[model samples]
Each structure stands twice: as C-alpha cells, then as structure tokens.
Target: MIENNRIKYSLAGFFMGVAELIPGISGATVAVIFKIYPNLMTILSKLRIKHLSFSLSSLSKKFQFDLLLPLIFSMIAAIILCSKAINFLLNNYEENFLTFLGCLMIILSLQIINFFKGILHQKKLFIFIFLGTSIGFILGQLDVESENISIFYLILSGVLAFSFFLIPGISGSSMLVVLGIYSPIIGAIANFNFDILIPFALGCLISLLLLPRLILSIYSSYEQSLLYLFSGLIASSGLLLL
Candidate 1:
C-alpha cells in the first residue's frame, strides 16, 4: 500500500512539473487536478517551526511529505531544465507561440473571472481590477535593460513569484515575463549557466522557506484582503498579454 502511494506521488510530481513549465499553466491547477490542491495549500499556508518539526518527525517513520515535496521540487527542476527548449520554440515559432500564449491567457482570464464572481459586488473590487490591469499593462511594456544577473533582482523575482504562487489563477512564469527576466533566466538554466541561475535559486529557496509562515499569518487575519490583492494581481497579469 505504501509503495503504491509513493509511485502515485512521484507521478503527480512529474505532471505538476510539466504543467508549471508551460507559461500560462498554474502549479496549483495541477495540484487541483491531482486532488492534492487543498492539502498542498493547507501545508503551504500552515507551515512553521512547530509544524515543520512535526512533519519532519512524521516523515522519519513514513513517506509523509511524499507527494507535495516531490511535486514541488520536480516542478522546479523541470522548469529549470525545460527553460531553454521552451524559449527556443517560442523564438523559432512566433505564431504558434503567440497562439498558445493567447489561449493560455484566455483560460487564465476565465479563471480570474470565476474567482471574482464571489466578490464582484464589493464596492472596491473594480478599483482593484483596474489597478491590476494598469500595472500588468505597464509591466508588459517595460523593456529588459539588464542582462547581468544580480542577487537583489533575483531575490525580488522570487518574492514576487512566491507571493503569486499562493494565489489561484496566477502564473509565476507570466510574472517572470513581466519582470523581463523570463527569457534570459530560462536561457541561463537551459544552458547550465549557473552564474545566472545560482542567485535566482537562492532567492527562490529563501522565498519558499519564508512563504508558508507569511501565508499562515495572512490566512489567519486578512484572508479577504489577501484574496483581493491576489485577484488583482491575476487580473493584471492576464491583461499583460493583450
């Protein structure tokens, strides 16, 4: 029984990683499809010192973090491994790439719409959407100026990406595109250029370490606000493709 479960967990991780590699697909969506979204989010949001210790002890006896940990790590690895190939395809096949991006963005927009339906009537909701849209548009227009990878920018990217990871319908890859690091960063990884990837990896590690605790605090006290902010971010990100 335990062995079967481990196989399933690994398979889930592989698929989730593939989904995450695609520009518009959400890792959370993959988790949802695999019937692990709620559990994953719960673990992510509630992770802290006490919970970590408990989870670690549980893992010593059994494959506790089995599915979630493998899934996340695999997804990250896949993204790094696949970045160059994806970029090559995108560059060589502009029409196909744009079409794929268009479809993905449309699906993402629908997801955002569904999310907003629950709070559509809120007086400030439109304002949030507008803000998100404006920001997304502006970000899309910004040019990538720096080719050199820096620790500060890498950390900033990780913080932004990690924050978006908690929100439904947001794509971390799309966030990378907006920040102008998507192509170069992916290229660095695809070619095994650690000079560029190392700092980004470090930033991602720090963000992952800190994110769970931050999520717990927000979920405990400011669920509504956090949801609004996330929704806005998603909406804006979707608008960027337009």
Candidate 2:
C-alpha cells in the first residue's frame, strides 16, 4: 500500500516536473488531474520553519516526507532528463503543443464555470473572475526590454515565477515573459549562469518561505471563488495560446 502511494506521488511529480519547465503549462493542473492537488496543497501549507524540529523523528513526523521525497526526486529527475526535449518542443512545435493544452484548459475552465452558475450573477464574484482573466491576458500581452536587466528585476522575476507556480492555472514562465526575462532565465538554466540566476533563485526561495501560508489562508476561506477566478485565468491563457 505504501509503495503504491509512493508510485502515485512519483508519477504526479514527474508530470508536474515536465509541466513546471514549460512556459504555458501549469504544474497545478497536472496535480489536479492526478488527484493529488489537495494533498499537495495541504502538505505545502503545513510546511513552515516553525514546524521543523531539531530532532529527526519529530521533523519526520511533522511532514509527509514519504510523499514528498519520491515526488521531489522524480520531479528533479524529470527536469534534468526532459529539459532539452521540452525546449525542443517549445521551439519547434509550440503552436500544436499549446493547441492541445489550450483545448484542455478550455474544457476545464468551462467545467469550473458551469459549477458556479451563481457566480455569473454576482457582481463581486464576476469581478474576481474578470480580474483573473485580465491578469492572464494583460501579462501575456506584455513586452519589455531584457537587455541590461537589473538584479532587482531578476529577483522580482523569480518571486513572480514561484508565486504563480503556487497559484493554479498560471505558469511562472508566462510571468517571466511579462518581464522580458524569459530568455535570460532559460539561458541561465542552460549555462548555469549564477550571476543571472542567483537573484532569481533567491526570489524563489523567499516565495517558497512566504507564499504557502498566505495561499493556504486565502484558499481556506475562498476555495470555490479562487477556483472560479483561476478558471478564468486559465481560459484566458488558453485563448492566448489558441
């Protein structure tokens, strides 16, 4: 039973890893499809520096390392092994690839919207969904100079990337596109350019530390509403791709 569960987690992580590297793909979507999204969020929100203990046993008791370990390792493996292939697909078959994903997103978004029929009538709820759509649409449309980019922006890029990664229906890569630092980020990955990536890495770390609790709070209160908003965000992303 334990091994089977680990296998499930590993598979989820592997697919999420692939999605994580792709610019438009949301890892959370993969998690949701695999039926691991709730568990993932719960484990993540439980993760806090305050929860860790100096004792190994106590620490292990606090976190689901059994689930986390295999998932993390598998994700790392997928990223390392599939990076080139993903880049190849993005470079050569972006339109076709995104078309399939776009259709999937549209279907999922429509399903979510259909669930909350009342959301259509409520001005405040509609506002949330519209705001989400606007964010995705506007962010996707943005273009800025990437040359001589500042460290501050690099850090900001990383923060945005990780934060969006936490959010459903949004990919951090899309956020990088907004900053015009997507190329630099990809280049940094290929070249291991610490100068460019370190600040960004720092931002990711900080986001990891901070966002989970806040995400948990908002999600706890407005789970359906957030899903409503995310559905719109994802639909917009899908439309942009199509």
Candidate 3:
C-alpha cells in the first residue's frame, strides 16, 4: 500500500495551479500529463452537492479527504500567490510573451494534427485551416479595450474558461485573456479583491463540477471530429497570438 504523503499533494497542486495561471496551459492537461487526471476526474465525478452532510459522509467513505484537502487548498493558494508575478510579466513583456505563446500554441496544434494520424485529408484540412484563420483573424482584430466590466461578465468569463479547462489543448487563462478580463482578474487576486473573485471562483467551481461529464459525453460521440475542431481552434489561437 502506498503511504499517504501531504508533500506530494502540495507539489501536485502547486504545479496544477501554475498551469492554471498560464494562458494556453490547462490544469487538466497538467494533471493528465502527470498521470493523475483520470483518478482526479473519477473523484470529482463522484462528488455530489445534493446535501452537505450526506455528501460529506458518502465522499469520506470513498475518497481520502486529508489528501484531497491539501491538494485543493494548495492549488487555491498557489493561484492566489502566483497571480501577482504572472501579472507583472504579462504587463511588462507582453510582446515577447505573446511571441513565445504563439510558438507554443503552434507546436501544440501540430501535435494534435499528428494525433489524427492521416485521418484528415488535405482538402478537409485546408477547409478547416481556412475557417480557423478567418475566425482567428476576426477575433484578433476585435478590440477588447473595455476594462470596466460587471460581476456577471466575470462569472461568465469563468464559465467559458472552465468549460475549456477539460479540453487537453485548450487554455482557460487564454480564454480569459481573449475575453479581456485576465488582467483585471489577476489584479483582483493580487489585491485580495473578493468582489470579482467570488463570482469568478463560483463560475469555475460550477463548471468544474458540471462540464467534464458533458464534455466526456460529447467526446464519446464525436471524438475524431472534436479533435479536428480543437486542432483548428488551437492553430487559429496561435495565429491570433502572432
């Protein structure tokens, strides 16, 4: 039997939190890469909010709360602690950062393309690529200048970000950036502003609780097409970054 280690949980949570901070980096991808995503998802899938006491009792029977609590707390702490540093880098070196991000995005997209294993014919790929380019160009051109957003928008941003959190190649932070709330959200974290964090965190929690099962259901039905579509999106996001 493996001995329980709080240190391991702390490290896992820290890395996952770091992954969450980076635009185009998914916490789910980090977990999957680290070989913990399957079990983590299995655990999350079993969580129920039907009743606080009953849920806790049932969860205690199947999951290690001591181990999980540390990981969860650590991730939250890391996200809060790291936000200031990430904000600094993004604010000061945005051009260079975008360049690096663009390259990384292209590389990730290429990996997905290969994952298809010659499944996408040249003609189909051309079409998807064209569509991707068009969508990316449009999104890139759109001005996200408004920083004075409402709480509802922040929650919505959280929903969108967390919805993409499960998709291996998708980055929730990148989505937040695209939505123009990334800077403000990070600022809120750094300044300890709960007004925005409350709604945003709620959205994330809700999505984390609900979205994975839906995504799995969808993937079960359209795995190949979904992969192709996501590949195109990743390719486009890379173009937009440049």
TM-score of each: 0.64, 0.86, 0.66
TM-score of 1: 0.64
lDDT per residue for candidate 3 within 1-242, as digits (tens), equals: 23446666767788778777777566765554444654565566655565235577666656667667777898999988997887787899988887887787677666755745655554465555556556555654555654588888878888988876776555787778778887888799889999989999988888878877676667667555555566666667666666
Better TM-score candidate (1, 2): 2
Candidate 2's TM-score reads 0.86
How does residue 29 of candidate 2 score in lDDT?
65
Weakest 10 consecutive residues of candidate 2 by summed lDDT: 112-121
Q: Pick the winner on TM-score between candidates 2 and 3.
A: 2
Segments in model 1 whose C-alpha atoms lie over 4 Å from true places: 1-16, 24-39, 45-57, 60-66, 73-93, 100-104, 111-123, 166-170, 220-229
Clash pairs, model 1 backbone? none
Evaluated against the true structure, the overall lDDT of model 2 is 0.82
The best candidate in terms of TM-score? 2
Query: lDDT by residue for model 2 over 1-242, one digit each (tens)?
Result: 98998999999999889888877777876776676776787788776778878998776666788888899999999999999997798799988988987887878776765745766576577777788889878878888777898999888888989988888787888788778888888899889999998999999988888887788788779877887788778888888888
Q: Between the candidate structures 1 and 3, which one is better when assessed by TM-score?
A: 3
Residue 218 deviation, candidate 1, in Å? 2.1
